[model samples]
Target: MGHLFSNYYEAVSVILFGIGFTTLLLNRNMIKKIMGFNIMDTAIYLFLAAKGYIFNRKVPIVTGEVPTPEQYINPIPAGLVLTGIVVSVSVTAVMLSLTIRLYRRYHTLDIDEITRLVKEEK
Candidate 1:
């Protein structure tokens, strides 16, 4: 039963990652692409954090009841995920800002259209 649940979680994570990757690759809108990238980052973070979580484990702390970290989930992966989330947010912000600039310069959001216009101008 536990194995089944674990497999399910892994499968779902993989599916999310694949969908996000495909969206990032196929989407033409800059905002959508950014969203897809964020989704991919989130999926990876979730996978990592989930992998660190152990069954029947308490939170990692030095409490009286749980004096040691033997039965607790590891914290390093979660911390890394937090950092990854921050980085992803920063990247998305920069990408969105660039998209806005592109929109302002070209007056269109379509990637192909913008490329054609830039080529024509050149």
Candidate 2:
């Protein structure tokens, strides 16, 4: 549709989210799952950034004379995006560390294998 084309960023983000969600569901490898999660996070960031942007608006900064609210884009989405990036990085770091520990102990990255090994150990 014409509206879909006009908002290409949202469309791309939706497509990326679907790919990431599929990957997350289908992949058994822990690393691949983490990568898929990161992809989903990136898609969210892109969607937020795109939605926050205006065609001909400036950043919400006071440079000279005071301007009306219409002259600048909303800052909340940008702030949310930045916060999301920090949280994503923290989560990724934790996930990677856990994966490394699992690989070291079980000598495998397949989640099903790990679950089986844990069950066998019990």
Candidate 3:
């Protein structure tokens, strides 16, 4: 029980990743695909944050007293996740904008319909 409890965040992250991947693969709507991408991105961020966490450790800030490396939780993963979040938001915005364009031009958000229209055009 304790072992499983300790890894709860990781477990949830894995579940979110699986769900996102499934949605991305199975969904036909462009908006649903974008949502799945966001979900996958959040899962990755959670996994990285969980990996960076340390039991009974302080934040990765140094004080007047000299502190060893292990005195604080590792900061690399957190930093990377922060950057990932920014990039993810930008990507999501772009995807949503493209989806809007597709909807305006194709009159539908369904991937199959859009592809069919494109093929008809050529």
Cα TM-score of candidate 1: 0.88
State the lDDT at 120 in candidate 1.
Answer: 98
TM-score of each: 0.88, 0.91, 0.86
Q: Give the C-alpha lDDT of model 3.
A: 0.93
Per-residue CA lDDT of model 3 for 16-105, tens digit only, reads 998888888899998999899899999999999999999999999988999999799999998999999999999999999999999999
- C-alpha lDDT of residue 45 in model 3: 95
Candidate 2, 1-122: lDDT as tens digits: 99999999999999999888888888999999999999999999999999999989999888889789999998899999999999999999999999999999999999999999999998
Q: Which candidate leads in lDDT?
A: 2
Candidates in descending TM-score order: 2, 1, 3
Best prediction by TM-score: 2
Query: Candidate 1, after superposition: displacement of residue 5 in Å?
Result: 5.4
Count of backbone collisions within predicted model 2: 0
* lDDT string, candidate 1, 1-119, tens digits: 78767577676787889988998999888778888898888889878988888989977766767366687889899889999989998988899999999999998888888889999
What does the lDDT read for residue 121 in candidate 1?
96
Alpha-carbon lDDT, every model: 0.85, 0.95, 0.93
